[model samples]
Target: MASPIDNNVSSAKAVLLGALASGVNGPTWSMIKITFLTLGVCLAAMLALAFSSSDFIMIIHVLLLVVISGILLVLLNRFLAETGLVSIEQQMEEMGIATKDQIELSKKS
Candidate 1:
């Protein structure tokens, strides 16, 4: 017979994996596209400026900051969403796993 702890571990892993895999199915993939667009728009305009000039150089620096901020925001959002879903699923699984273990232990008794 499997230990209740083993079952819980596997259940937790499965829930987290499924929650993560959910990203592949929809607008979750859209994060890359949006981030890329923001980066391009910010960087390209300054690139179009001639002479490697000081003003445009400063603009390029600001665009780099925007790119960093934009990418970080998207990543944090994705991480939090995935983690929240996994947490909810794990909580639900805990109740079901506990009941099954109780029944198994009762049978053993």
Candidate 2:
């Protein structure tokens, strides 16, 4: 018989693997798409600022700040996405619902 700890580990591993395999699945994809869109808009804005400014030093400063801010935004987005996925999986497990069955039930409902 397996110990409870072992069972929990297995379940956690399964959940993580399932999450990775389902990359950008419905809800996550929506969040990711938003993140990308936001980044694109910010980049465009930075480029416009750089072009409209007369000072070379100011342009360089704006570009550097934009790069750092973009990196931070991407990292935060990734962290939030992972956290959201884990919470979602835990909620499903607590409700005693497997992914496939959940899908089928949702379709039926």
Give the top-scoring candidate (TM-score).
2
Candidate 2's C-alpha lDDT?
0.57
Clashes of each: 0, 0
Residues 53-83, model 2: lDDT tens digits:
7778877877887788778778867876675
What's the residue-level lDDT of 19 in candidate 2? 56
TM-score of 1: 0.30
Candidate lDDT scores, in order, read 0.52, 0.57
Task: Score every model by TM-score.
Answer: 0.30, 0.39
In candidate 2, where is summed lDDT lowest over 10 consecutive residues?
1-10
Query: What root-mean-square deviation over C-alphas does model 2 reach?
Result: 11.5
